[model samples]
Target: MTITEELINKINVCTKCSLHKGRTHAVPGEGSYNAEIMFIGEGPGRDEDLQGKPFVGASGKLLTELIKSIGLSRDDVFIANVVKCRPPENRDPLPEEIAACWPYLDQQVRIIKPLLIVTLGKHSMGRFLPGLKISDVHGQPKRAKGIFNERQVYLPLYHPAVALYDPRKKDILFEDFKKIPLILKQIKKSKNDIQ
Candidate 1:
């Protein structure tokens, strides 16, 4: 079995945090095993809690459109949240919750070894790019060193949910989404030139 599968199994039975006590189902994440891009969001929301899948709410629909704009689909990339369970009323996940859930995300990064990790929200941006403000830094791709052996690229982005409530943010997100295709192309071309 792949590392992702192993990690999924472990996450399915995770009880490291108090959030697990209220969870109806664990969102272990899902996507292509060979996906080059991985999207990491903050946590499951209400719709997610009901369906036991990550990003199933209206935000997810917007996310789908964003991915489609970049000439990709959900099936083309992997998706997961920083926290697998829903926090109460969509409140910010506590530091302890992040602590309890971090190892799983760490393990995921190792397993997939994605070419790029796109953080969708401030919290996820915190883990990858500490002390970075979402307003100033969204859409900026920084090469994060020493996370996994592969030296993955990290791109902090505003979450789709933020755009849902604000129309102008949606336009900004679309503009940022346009960058994905070019970025992926650069990575692909670089690899070919290297070889």
Candidate 2:
């Protein structure tokens, strides 16, 4: 089996935390194995849990549009969550839950080796950049050591769900998303220069 397939199989049967007991299915993530970009989110919500897919609800629609705006499709980038299963009543994942699922996410990053990781909420961002507010860092690219590499690049953004509550964040999300391609170009240029 492919490595991703193996990972998914493990996730499917995972009972590492309480979150699994209530989940309809484990969202192991989806998209190109060779993608340059990977999107990490907090966890699966109602729609996503039911469908066993990440970002398939209203927020997902906006995320889809944002990806399209950058001239890429769902097939072009990887999407996964910090927690593979949905928390009870869509509550925040507990610390133990995140810790239990950390190995899986770490394996994914090691496998995909994405040039950029776009964290789509505070929970996901907190894993990489602790002690920072999303408001201060959204749309900005920060380079640091990640689960897989020392030079991983990350871009923090508000969860698309935020726009559902306040429409203003939608415009900001779009603007922030616009920086992706440019940041990717710069990363590639630097890599080439190093070689």
Per-residue lDDT of candidate 1, residues 1-195 (tens digit): 966677878887889998988888889777876789999999999888888887889999999899888878899998999999888888999999999999988877777778888999999999877888999988877765636854557778899999999999999899988887777777766653211
lDDT by residue for model 2 (73-162), tens: 999999999999999888888999999999999999999999999999999999998888999989989887777777788999999999
C-alpha RMSD by candidate, in order: 2.8, 2.3
- My TM-score estimates for the predictions, one after another, are 0.92, 0.96
Pairs with steric clashes in candidate 1: none
lDDT for each candidate structure: 0.85, 0.92
Candidate 2 weakest lDDT stretch, 10 residues: 186-195
Instruction: State candidate 2's TM-score.
Output: 0.96
Task: Please state the error at residue 178 of candidate 2 in Å.
Answer: 0.4
Top-TM-score candidate index: 2
